[model samples]
Target: MTEQRKDILDMLAAGKITAEEAEQLIAALERDQAPAAAGLDARPKGKVKYLRVVVDATDNGEPSRVNVRVPLQLLRAGVRLAALVPPQALVKANASLSDSGVPIDLTQLKPEQLEALVEHLDDVTVEVDSPDATVRVFCE
Candidate 1:
């Protein structure tokens, strides 16, 4: 029905191209356009707003799945809130986190840094596959 498809059929009708050749051309055209047609939600890479974690596993021989979508705006807001906390409280929180093996400095959390981190996350995707479980982490 498309112009290119019509052209291919016309070529076949005129005997300029064989039926097989016309079929191949139509198939190639569909393949080339499939991604663009299917990607209805395509967005700019820099505009990634959610951090997604998806897990599928067999638990006790029963299949289970987990899908989590966390908005990047929530993290940005948390970072902004951290700025209002007293320095003494931040130090205590940092120490507690370190004691718990987190090793993160709460005082170092800045909104700009979080934004930059989220932007970089757009380019990162992590996948873990095993017989029992599969995990995927990406930005969307």
Candidate 2:
């Protein structure tokens, strides 16, 4: 065990820190050390290429299912295309979207922002489960 881990354990044994506090400290240490400790495993595994959504549901004795996989490259292409659209058209579209309760401004989107969003997507997985349905959205 590392000296930090030993210190944490000693603190716990001495009642100087609560168990939960010790666990949290250990977890933080592990997260901080993971990349260095991983060595060869720290290399990128693979690029995320797709955004996926899956749904399964039953409603009033009827069942439904849906599965979707969207290419990440398509999103990049769309962002590029958005730049080609006329500003007036983008304004109109933005107004329409607002009217439809989508409060988004197309004119504000930037390539760098989109790239950041794509990077963050790799760490995001959304899942919902209820008595009647299950839904998941993630990147792969």
Which candidate comes out best when scored by lDDT? 2
Model 2 TM-score is 0.62
RMSD of each: 11.2, 8.1
lDDT of 1 by residue, 32-58 (tens): 888877785574436788989999999
Relative to the true structure, candidate 1 reaches a TM of: 0.55
Tell me how far the alpha carbon of residue 133 in candidate 1 is from the true structure, in angstroms, after superposition: 2.6
Give the per-residue lDDT digits (tens) of candidate 2, residues 1-140: 99999999999999999999999999999998997878767777668899999999997899999999999888777767766889899899999999999999988987678777876777789999999999999999
Clashing residue pairs in all predictions, respectively, total 0, 0
Candidate 2 residue runs with Cα over 4 Å from true position: 1-44
Error of 2 at 2 (Å): 12
Off by over 4 Å in 1: 1-46
